[model samples]
Target: MTIVLTFMPFAVGIMDNDLRQLLAQVARGDRTAFAKLYDVVSGRLFGIIGRILPRAELAEDALQETFMRIWQRASSYDETIASPMAWMATIARNQAIDLKRRSAERLAALASELDETLADESPDPESLAGQAGDLRRLGECMQGLPNERQQLVLLAYRQGFTREELAERFKRPVTTIKTLLRRSLIALKECLDGAR
Candidate 1:
């Protein structure tokens, strides 16, 4: 009789452990461990970027850039303030912002490509409103909140505007936008939960 026993090291803090250790191993030139870590975290990492960027093409680009940074900066992550994934989150966020900026620049350059006859007119509001049912649903929920909170949510999600971007757009301090978005998201979550 032949018997086989399977051992899962991660279950007891081996393979399934937090990212800091995997990153440390990566820093030491361990490619195998890095591959494993990538397989484990890529889904959640993609989800975070997808929520912020929305476009599949942009999200995919950010995802690739994010993993590349993880391999390069694995040694620089500070474990005191946050975990390795938090560091990865920051990198992913920056990549998404870069992608958005590039896309905006490209769109600006292509503005003249539209024919003047078509460009002079605006789309019908009813058609737009009908197509924006999803946005309207979310907007309805947001409109129920205070004015400040509603604006913060809109600036963050609608325009893919980061706190720093919102600060610059609003001609306010970065700290103000940060505080507003943080508080607004928390309040919105609570309101959503109460409805549930």
Candidate 2:
């Protein structure tokens, strides 16, 4: 299906108060509140995502990612900085961009796109096998962490977010961010080392 994406002005003030209340409840780990928030805001967020990714499938993927991030990072939302929808819109936009970049990079890097194998086309089978195995094992290790910690790890390592950025996003002190990251890395190392 074709998806036509366009940027349009969003109506404000109507749900701002309720959204703030819902976000507060979500921060306290109320799943019902989260569900309400989703029901209230998903359409607008989807529109925001669609504006970044024209393809229906890709926009849908971005919308899912945005909500997943919102669910994971609810505790970090601060009403002082921006309105609830604004904060969520930023997340949706960032996720859409990330998804778009990944899609492009994957397409460009696909082995199937290559006409002929060259010396630099890819690593040898042994190296590729080992790398894939290591990645799988690492993913397994990451799954052992709590969801919040897992998101923090991904933001820090995969997205290259600075400690300051993490502290701001997570609403934690820099020292706390450092401590948590260190602890998480140690746990991952332990898991990886002990798995074999």
Candidate 3:
């Protein structure tokens, strides 16, 4: 059984040969080998996709697309240029980028359609001004945070990183990450309230 240590830092190790062999077998349409390969690498791939895609459903779709591409392109695996995991990770990252691009394009098209339909309607200037003021206040509050706290807050909220994921990335305990986030959020709230 392959022990998948997905949260470990990336390091080229002896498992590359085994992964290469698995890819070769998958290229030949070996279902068992493909299953084994998925079992070994899917956790790491999911984590990568999650970090990129933010939304869980989108990340799940990207992961499915990544595996589909892996099955189709397994024959192109070249161990000489990069490790097997590296190649697979590249495919997963590209898949996430493609998904993000497609989503952006779809949103842009929808926005264009909405703009055409609402061409006669004007946005309320008072509401817009209020929104701008709120945004400015929020930005100031965020800027007041220390750099590390700012990064942690942005990663947790904007990037959708879980506490466990932050802990792993920061090499800290999960409880510590939670406490830091709590303190940072409280500070931000206080700053925003004071600004108001």
TM-scores of all candidate predictions against the true structure: 0.49, 0.53, 0.56
Residue pair clashes in candidate 2: none
Best by TM-score: 3
RMSD of model 2 against the true structure = 17.4
Backbone clash count, each prediction separately: 2, 0, 0
Candidate 3 positional error at 154, Å = 32
Winner on TM-score (2 vs 3): 3
lDDT of 3 by residue, 1-196 (tens): 8987768665456578789889999999999999999999999999999899988889999999999999999998888888899899999999999999998786667546534633555459778877788878888999989998898989987788887899999898665676688778779879978887
Better of 1 and 3 by lDDT: 3
What C-alpha lDDT values do all the predictions have? 0.73, 0.83, 0.85
Which TM-score value belongs to model 1?
0.49
Order of the predicted models by lDDT, top scorer first: 3, 2, 1
Per-residue accuracy of model 2 over 36-94 as CA lDDT, tens digit each: 99898889889888888978888998988888888889889988899999999999999
Best-fitting candidate, scored by lDDT: 3
lDDT by residue for model 1 (36-107), tens: 888988997899889878878789999999999889988887778766767788898888888888877765
Error of 1 at 61 (Å): 1.0
**Residue 42 displacement (Å), model 1:** 0.5
